[model samples]
Structures are given as C-alpha cells and as structure tokens.
Target chain A: MSESPSQPAQRRTALDALHRTLGATMTDFAGWDMPLRYASEREEHQAVRTRAGLFDLSHMGEITVTGPQAGEVLDYALVGHLSALAVGRARYTMICAADGGIVDDLIVYRLGDQEFMVVANASNAQVVLDAVTGRAARFDAAVRDDRDAYALLAVQGPESPGILKSLTDADLDGLKYYAGLPGTVAGVPALIARTGYTGEDGFELFVAPADAERLWQALTGAGADKGLVPCGLSCRDTLRLEAGMPLYGHELTTALTPFDAGLGRVVKFDKPGDFVGREALTAAAEKAAATPPRKLVGLVAQGRRVPRAGYPVTDASGAVVGEVTSGAPSPTLGVPIAMAYVDAALAAPGSAGVAVDIRGAQEPHEVVALPFYKRER
Target chain B: MSINPEQLRYSKEHEWLSAPEAGVATVGITSHAADALGDVVFVQLPEVGATVSAGETCGELESTKSVSDLYSPVSGEVTEVNQDVVDDPSLVNSAPFEGGWLFKVRESAEGADLLTAAEYDAFIAG
Candidate 1:
C-alpha cells in the first residue's frame, strides 16, 4: 500500500526480497518496511529463548566517528566515557540534550584506537547524526552517516555460539562479551560482535550491504541443524522487553533523562572534559538519589489479561500512579510482563496495591524486579 | 488457509456465524481476522446471558502484537462461551473455525446483511 504523495515512502532493507520469499508479514516500523513475523510471533520468540533465532537488523542506524579525537568527541557528545573504552570493545551509552533529556540509547563500538561506530535506533538516526556532528564541530574528528553502508544481522539464543562457530574463523570463544573483531564469515568480510538485544549469547555481524544476502544464506544453511529460525521485529520487541532493555522511543525519549529511566549508570559524571547535559544530569542524579520524581519498575500481570503500552497503572484507590511503557505476553514466562514508570514512592519491587487498567477492567499486576527472563550463563 | 464454509454467514467485521438451529448459532472470528491478529494471547467473550447488539463491540482479542475489538454480528444473548479457546487462545490462530469458536448466542434479531461464503471471500479479497 502506498502512502499519500505528501508522505515519504518507507525504506526497505537489503533482505526485503528474501523476507518476502519466506512469506513474512511485513509492517511499517520507524519508516522501514520490515518483517513483523515469518510464521508465528510466539513461535519466533520461543525460538530465540530456547534454540536460536536470526534477525535482519539492517534497519538500525550506524554512524561512524573517525580521527585522532574520535573517542574524545564521543565523550563530549554522549553521556558515556567512551574515551576510556579499550579497542575492539563496545559500551552501552546514551546521548542527551542540554536539558538532560535523552536523545537516544546507543551502543558505541571502538573499532580502533582512532575510530568508533555508534549504533542508534532506526527512527532517530538522523537526529543522532545531527547532534553528534554539531557536538564534534571543534574536535579533530569527522562524523559520517554509515547507515546505508552496512547490513547488520544477529544470531541469538543458547545455540548461537555453535551455529556461528561453524561459519566464522574469528575467535568466537575468545571474543568476550561486548567485543567485536574484523573477520571473514562464510567468505564475506564482517565485523562480528558478541553482542545482541535478545538477552542471549550471540553475535551481531555487520557486513557490506552487497554481501547481506549471501551471508544470510550461509548463516541459515549453517544454523539449520542447530535449530536456528529467521526471526522478525515482533519477536525482537518481546525479547528485548523480557531482557528489560529500554527501547529508544518507549523507555527513552526526549522528554525523559537517562536517570529518569533508571539508566543513570550509563552517564559518567567524572569524565575529563565538559559534556552535553552534564550539569543538568549531575543535578538530576543527585535528585534521583534523594527524591526522584518517577521510577521505572517491572510489572507482572497477576491475571491472564495482557497489559499493553499506554495503559494506565493504578494504585489501590484507583488513582493513576504510573503508565506502562512496554508490555507483552511473555512467551518464555507464559505470563504478561510490562515495564512502567510509576511514582517513586511505589516503585519498589513487591510494593503492594498495583494494577493495570486494561480497558475498563482493573487487571491485578505485581511489581517485581526487572528482566522477567534471564538466560543462564 | 481454510476456506470459509459455504454453510456459514459472514459479517463485515470478520465474524462468521453458523446457520441458527432453534434460534441459537455458533460464532467465531473468520480465519482472515485470526491471521491478521497473530498469536492470540487472550480472548474476552461476552458473559453468558449478556445481551450484545449487532455491530457493537462485545469483547476483545489481545494478540502478542496488538489488540482488536470483537464485534457481535447479530443482536443476541450470549448463551455460552468457549472456555477452551479462552484457556488456549492460540487455538484462534490454529483452528479458527472449529475448536476456536468463540461463543454461542440465542439470536433475538437478525442483522439482515450477513454475506454468503462467496460474498465474504470477495469482500476480503477486495
């Protein structure tokens, strides 16, 4: 279906034709025409939790910062102390506006001592590029939009190691978590990083767009016996939600700070030089320690009814105390789980009297610790 | 996908109704609707003895990805709801016509606009 002439067209990934051949149901996500599911969302989700699931993550944004001061520029542009990160390692960080509001949660990979790659959300790619580019105006580094240059794919689950080991010569065993190494996988050049959003032991391969189809076929062929299935974005949402990872638009937004989302640990206050949002975030951090306004907490439904995003969370007296940010029927847990921003006083896990207003009905939900499911290491 | 049974009548809201026997009929969501709502996690049917007006929302079907309104195709009193489908909502996706039949209703009034199987097929195709 085409949009009106005034609306921009949705972008497709390198694997668009392949996804169609596999009978995937496509949906518009963040201006990208991406696969929502291949067969069943629950089955896809369970595959990632039990066996292995492969994902086409080419829709994610990749921005490159290079030069002598690349790391320094990141330190000032984003909240994390990226300059301290060792080569070949990645750090989960965020970029915030001057008002202490988060721009986007990112993963910064230090490819070399003088080069770094910042992975951003699909919807906020341009926003991140603009922010970082402006912040790097005085630094000796150059920022470039590399979104279209790479096709990213991930194989995640318990069997991921075995599945990937068969195709790559890279030291998958020695590649510690959050580490990436340049290598050839199935005769194609790739950056294999032992990082994923599925809360599993996995590898994310960043390869040239031209080689995506071949790489995908090789991975599919190699992973077939290991029980790997091609997954879609629908399952990816549930997987990340179960892992308690905050999505950029949902848990993080320009209206909320990393501190507000309970991600203040990503913001380093003791960095060598001044950084954006430092002053505001420093005060926000102090306020959070003393008396935070709202706190994010995990909510597990006590009933079979699913609690959905934007549903109001109420207290014992039926007063709105919070709002759900992300929620889904957890395939692994077999119950509805959610993440919500509740009033600070009632944010503690196991706090009494919490429920989600599902339509007109008040479905009971228990406040619990986050990460509804954690894979055993 | 299973074709809509010729003996059944369909509504534009994607509900299928079996021919009423003694003023009571079986109702379920069409396979087309079930396919659109992936991996149904929960189904809320109108309670037994509750009156549902035609073309009005009676309940909800919550899938993993979204929630959809379940509309009553005819004005009737819900006589029985399928607890089997409620207990295992995935049945809606697996067997929408048979095991996943949502509810039974004692028809009080007909909508006068139910489509035949062929008409329903053409409607969805369009």
Candidate 2:
C-alpha cells in the first residue's frame, strides 16, 4: 500500500484519461497506472461509509475457465470447493503453491455450468493465470487469461443500490450477495456481481474495455444526487482495513499459509480428489489447531500515532513479538486500527501486553476483533 | 503552490517560523507540506522545556499515506504546544498558519539564520 519502487514501464487502464482529467494522483501499483485518490482520502473514505463511491478496478486480472471439467479443474487449482458451487454464485478462495503457501486469494464466480471467472489481484494476476492454467492441463478445461479484454468497475456503499438501479435494468433489489448475472448496464454489456471488498452492499461490474469510460460517466452522472464520488486506492485501503478484509500482499502473502492468516475455512478438506497443497495444508491445519504459531488480529492504537505496515509489535516488556500488516486512521471509528500477526496466546481481544513500536516509541494498544466497523443492515 | 507568508521565515524542511517576539516565536508546517502529506491525522509536537536544535527533527507528523518528521527550524527551548492541533490534527491542513501552529519556542542565545519568503519560494520551486 506504500509507494512503489521505480520500474521500467507502467501500464494504464481503459479509464486512464478519465482519471487524469479528474486530477487523480497516479501511482504505480503492481506495474499499473492507478489512482491513489481523487480528492481527500478521508472524505472519500467517509463518503463510501455514508453514501456511495465508484472505483475503477480495471487493473484486477480476470481469468476464465470454461469447459465440461471447469469446475473440477478449479476444485483442484484452488483451495475452495469450486465443483460444488452453484452457477451464478461466487466463492472467496485462495490459490496456493504446492507447499500450501498462499499464492493469491480469489473470487471465483460461476458464470455458467461450464464457465467460471477467477478475479485475482493485479500483482498476482499472472501467477494465478499460470497456476490455474498449469493445473488445468490434465482436465478437460481451457483456461484463458481475459484480463486485457475486460474493464472492472465497482460502486460500493449504502446508496449503491439506488444509484445503480438508475443505470441498469437488472433486478438490483433481488441480487443476493456473492451472486452475479449478465446484464446490460448503461447500454453496455456487463456481468454485474453483488460482491465487494468494502464489506458494504455494492456491485462489481465487468464490461468491455471500450465501454469503460462511458460506464463511468453514466454512473457518475446518475449518482450525482446520491453522494457518490470517485474513490481511489487510498480510501479503498482504509475502508477495507476498517471492514477487516485482507489485501493479498498485506494480510495474505506467499510466506503465510491460509491457516496462518486465519482463512483456513476456505480450505475444503472433504472434497474428493487430491488438490494442490491439500496434503500440506492439512498438516499445517492440524499443527495450527494444536498450537498456532501466530494469528491475525485487530489492534487499535490508544494514542494518535498510527502503526503502519512492517512496524514491530511488542509485548508488555517491549519485546518484538510480531509485525503489523495493514493499518490506517479510520474515519468512521475515529481511531487508528491495524492488523497484525501476533502469538496465538496474545491474539484474543483485550489481551494484555500489546503495543506497537511506532518509531522506537512503544505505543500501547488493545487487541480487538477482526473488523472494527460493521454497518447496520 | 500555496503562497508563503511574508512575515514568517521558512525552513528547507517546509516549516514556517514566525519572527521571535519576547524571545518566543511560533512554529507550524507550511501549506505545501500539508498538501504533500494529505490530510493530517496525527501531529506529535515537542514537549515544553525540551531543547531542540535547528535543522533537527523534533517531533513527527502522520497522514493517511505515511509519516514525516517535524523539523525544528531554529534552536530553542519549547515554550508552548498547541493543544487544539494535538487534539484535532486536521487543523494543520485546514488552517496551517493560525490554529495549526504546532508549538512556541524561546530562542536560544545563538539565533539561527532562516530563509525569506522569496528565497523559500525559489527553493521549493527548484
């Protein structure tokens, strides 16, 4: 979530011109030219919690697996029980290496009986593509990298339904969470999914690249009175942090298994057939259940100083026990919250002897639950 | 770029120092610094009676994006700290020159030379 190091080149999304025209602070995110924020990040963060916010997520990679054995192939490729997923439903799962380390967490949306869309993070797009493709080589399925062919947009928040209802003829009221369907939005073909990372009611619209700008314009215009604003990666980070959603590089990483990140529920052990990382993850799960090394927990700083990623987490005596993964000054909670990997003994809420080393000063904090904020439904 | 106040002296670290009166001068970060840092979430000011040196980091400022050190423009003993800004850090961004003043410092015997508004402007432009 910090600044990217200088790279040789960067890629632009379909709405690059639109974002630049609106004076977005462009940053290099996983080699893609993406907006960090359009206006005040705090204001944008608050807007999403209160009203609505639009996001250009074209950089997120999409891979399609289609054929008779597509579901079986995904069951072998990912940690979730994809073969049992009903059509039009989405499952949050992770693609892991053979050793059970997380490669990437994904949202697998079953578009049809033989078709499923795997949305991966921008940094892990190619990794997921290669992993899924290689895993499906033996199955009667075809894995196609459709990232460059589609543009993704997300309108998230409380007022999302009303704003999106104005643009699309689809049954926004009936769209259940984690379900997706093909429909025309703003006169453009799209796959509208009732899923979001912000932990709010929202839709993730997938459209063709050429129609991205038009879709964005239509949403902004239709959402004028709904308090929808163009949000960027900055506010998105804080929002997800507040919601306790894990980002790939932060909460989930290659070095940590799904069990270590407290995401062992995504691993389906009862599924038939040997899947990649199944044996190793099973062992890791058993060991973790016995005596977990470290677990992810929420931390709220008692003082003003915000504990950032990679900062050392200290015990009562100021001994380094863990490290912070993601943190921000939450606009909704009016306090600084963070996710850290601490010893399992100290992972419970209100555990004592917890502090964050904020630039050599051991600022005390309280270990709270995963999410610091939850919207009233 | 925002205009640098003519009455206040400047520091290369993007801090503004008011002319010392009664051996005390006020301190605050410039608008440019606030703009670069985005909305300020936390401001750590030097405690009263603490001795600081010119061009040294005395405290820290944190934003949503990252953290930056608050540099002391002139060496002095910290006299007063702004409790308002310490409570509501956004004052540093909304009213940086007035209510956002971080602290007041009593000048040392060996006063430090600082930049004029034009010189600071030229320095930032370069």
Candidate 3:
C-alpha cells in the first residue's frame, strides 16, 4: 500500500472515466493508463471462465495496409503466408527482422483484395508499423497507423457471441473464426472480428476512439442479459495464460527465433518464392530441423505458493535448469501453474519434476503439457 | 466490515490484535489488509510455535502480482495457525478479519501499541 511512484506517459482511453466510476486501480501498462483490476483478481478471473468478460483494448495498434500491392507487401514482411489470406479473413503472423528473430506477432486481417489491417500489441505497434511501412516501400503499398483513430474492445467468453449478436445484425455465425465483418451496433458503425486471446468464443470490436464509451455502454447494456462484465488486465493475463497464449515480452522476443516459440508453422518458406527473413528462416529452419532450441513447457507447482516470473527452476539434484516465464496461482485450476523454457530433451511430458525455490525453500513442481486449460470454443 | 473496536485493535501493517484474556494476545490480519493484497494464492505463514518479535517479519503472503509479508504486531509464539486460510487462502482476501485471518499469537507482552479504528484508517489512507 505504498504510493504508485511513477506517472504513466500514455494517454488514458475512453474507458478511463468508466474505470474511475467503477473504482478500478490504475497502473501504467505499456505507456497506457490501464486498470490492473476492478475488484478481486480471482473474482474477475472466475467471471471470465464461468461467464463473459469485456476488455478495453483501445491501446492496441491497428495498422491499415491498402494498396494494389498490399498483399505483396505483407507477404514480404510477415512469416505467415499473407498472400493466401482471402478477403475478410485474418491470420496470426509474426513480423520478423532479416536475422530470423521476430519483431512482433500480429493479426493480419485481409479486409479486401488490396486492403489488410494488422492488429499488433500496443507496446510494439510503432515497431511493427515501421517494419511494415519500410517493407511496403519496396512493393508499392501504403501503410496507415490507425492506433489513435480507433478503440478496440474484446467481448470474450462462452457467452460472448450470443450477447454480441443481440446488439448487431451482422450474422456473427457467418463470420467464421479468424474472420471479421463491418457492421453497426446501436447505430454505431464498428468492425466486429470473431477472434480473441481468451479460449472462448468471442468478438473483438474496433470502433472510433471518440465513440468508445458509448459503444462500451451499449454493448454492456445489450450484453446484460448474457452476463457480460468488464474485466481488466489482471484477469486478462490469467485467461491468456490458461489458453497458453504468449505475452510479448514474456515468451516472444526480438532475439528469440520463431522456431524457439513453437510458432515455426507461421514461417512459410514456399510462399511468394522469397520474403524478408526467408533465407534466415530457412537457415534457422534447417538448423532447427537438425537440433531444435530449448522448448517452452508448462509446469504445475506442487504447493499452493506459485512459482512467479523470474523464479529459477532446478532439477532433482538442485542443478539450475530454466527460468519461469509466466506463473500464477490459477484461479480456475485452484493450483499454481507456470510456463518455462527448458532443454528440448527435458521438455517431454512426465520426464521428471523440478523444484522452484519460492523464497529460500524448495517448492516441487512437475512439467505438464501446455495449455493448462482449454474449451472447445 | 464492522470495526470491532475493543475485540481487537489494528496496526499500520493492517494486522489486528485481540487482547488476550491474560498476557497472550491473539493476533490476525484485518479484512482490508487481505483485499489490499488481492487474491491470496499462497501464504508462507510462520511455523506453528515459531517465535516472533514485535514489528518483525513473521511470514509472507503471495498474491498473483506481488509478495508481501505479515508482521508480528506483538512478540509471541505462533500458538495456533489458521489452516482454513492455508488450504483455501483466498479466504484471507475475501474475509480477512474472520475466516481470512492468518494466525493466532500467544503474545510475549500483555499489550501491544494497537491503533484505534480512526488511526488505522488514517494510516491506510496516507
């Protein structure tokens, strides 16, 4: 209960007013004033699991690529086969440097034959934009940084689609997974995408920044019948962690190659003949095909004390092994869950258990297959 | 949420102490203390019967975001432990004063410098 020492440099979102009204504890996240949690983290977490949760994600960056060579430009920049993505479809892609290290992972949405909208994590938006626009110059395409103009809201959970459908006439069922549609909700034009980080059926709504509050209120009003509650970044972490989704700085890094992240499938060497990082990716792929890098694995801590981030993992003989990347006492699992990178040889399920020195004491843990939990939706 | 004025007094550390019938006061953390700590996932309570000195670190309470330690408001032996909080630790956060209480202490001194309701609230506010 010490005072928050630092002030956030980033501007507050349209939800800041609402957050204040709801008595949210604000924290500086990626330069943005974001709510850490509304009330209890576990309570917020349980709501998302058993019901629906809405997220204020206006800080995320949306880059619009529209030109005759838009697809060609993206095909050159991203690891995923962007050229094959049809209009109104979205695919998860990683933008990488020429050295085969990932610059950023983004969702590339093919809005038209020549228009692609790339949604990147808030912190890395500028970097992704620079890389995309820089590459676009070589292919005669245009890139627009649309971060300020729009706000993104995620309505995530098992009940999300049902609640969202009640507000709009845009046949949400027709919009397949990883697809999007432009429609109006409560007389407000919005772009609804059937995509989210939560391991539940949901929609990510992108709307005008000025209209963010109104859109949020409207959805909450419409979604009241379906039990939608506004969630914060605290629960967002647990939800994504349960789904085994990687946070930018935690799992993925500019130095870590795609193959190291179990996302090598995103690199399409055969697509478009050659692209940025193609040679490097092929080299890395060949290098990986022979001897892969250390793999990331999930661990279930034996005790109630969670193995937090930066905690060292040790073998049976007290030999320092890997480090814990993400960990928490999973509200859903009712136990401590963690993810760590270990030697590929030792990453197999049930190979052996390890101990995490929680403070000065050794807390035992076992390697488990990732995602700690999942739903069919 | 009732401020039990006489049953137990409070500390800036958010600990509460019920005056012992004799010299052994029973100490536990308050409900506000638990909510401020967020979801109580793991609590490293001092061993039962472990000696604790006043204004000293007793044990740790780890939440999803950070780790905080409970302080011994009065020097004593950890005569009794709260197993309910240890098993379902969130009880500490949900009901910090009652079922969420951390531990009971057999005080070394007859009395501790406990804060009144107004004092603890003002300390928390500042």
Question: Ten-residue segment with the worst summed lDDT in candidate 1 chain A?
Answer: A1-10
Interface RMSD (Å) of candidate 2: 0.7
- Which residue ranges in model 3 land beyond 4 Å of their true spot? A1-8, B1-13, B18-21, B30-32, B109-120
Please report the TM-score between candidate 2 and the true structure. Answer: 0.94
Ranking by DockQ: 1, 2, 3
Compose the digit string of candidate 2's lDDT tens values, residues B1-126: 448889999888989999889999999999888877888998989999999888899999999989999999988899999999989999998989899999999988323657889998888888
lDDT of 1 by residue, A170-253 (tens): 889899999998999999999999999988889999999999999999999998988899999999999999999889878889
Stretches > 4 Å off in candidate 2: A1-6, B6-9, B109-126
Model 2 chain A poorest ten-residue lDDT run: A1-10
Candidate with top DockQ is 1
Going through the candidates in order, the fraction of native interface contacts each one reproduces equals: 0.74, 0.79, 0.74
- Would you give me the overall lDDT of model 1? 0.93
lDDT of each: 0.93, 0.92, 0.83
Model 3: per-residue Cα lDDT over A64-179, one tens digit each: 99888888888888888887898889898899999998888899888888888999998899999998888888777899999887889998888887788778899888999999
Q: Choose the strongest candidate by lDDT.
A: 1
Tens-place lDDT digits, model 2, residues A1-377: 34456645688999999999999988889989999998799999989999999999999999999999999999999999998999889999999999999999999999999999999999999999999999999999999999998999999999999999998889887789999999999999999999998878899999999999999999999899989999999998999999999999999998989999999999999997889999899998998899887889999999889999999999998888899999888888888889999988788999998999998899999999888888889
Go through the candidates in order and give the clash count of each: 0, 0, 0
Question: Can you list each candidate's DockQ?
Answer: 0.80, 0.79, 0.69
How well does chain A score by TM in each candidate? 0.98, 0.97, 0.96
Number of the predicted model whose TM-score against the real structure is largest: 1
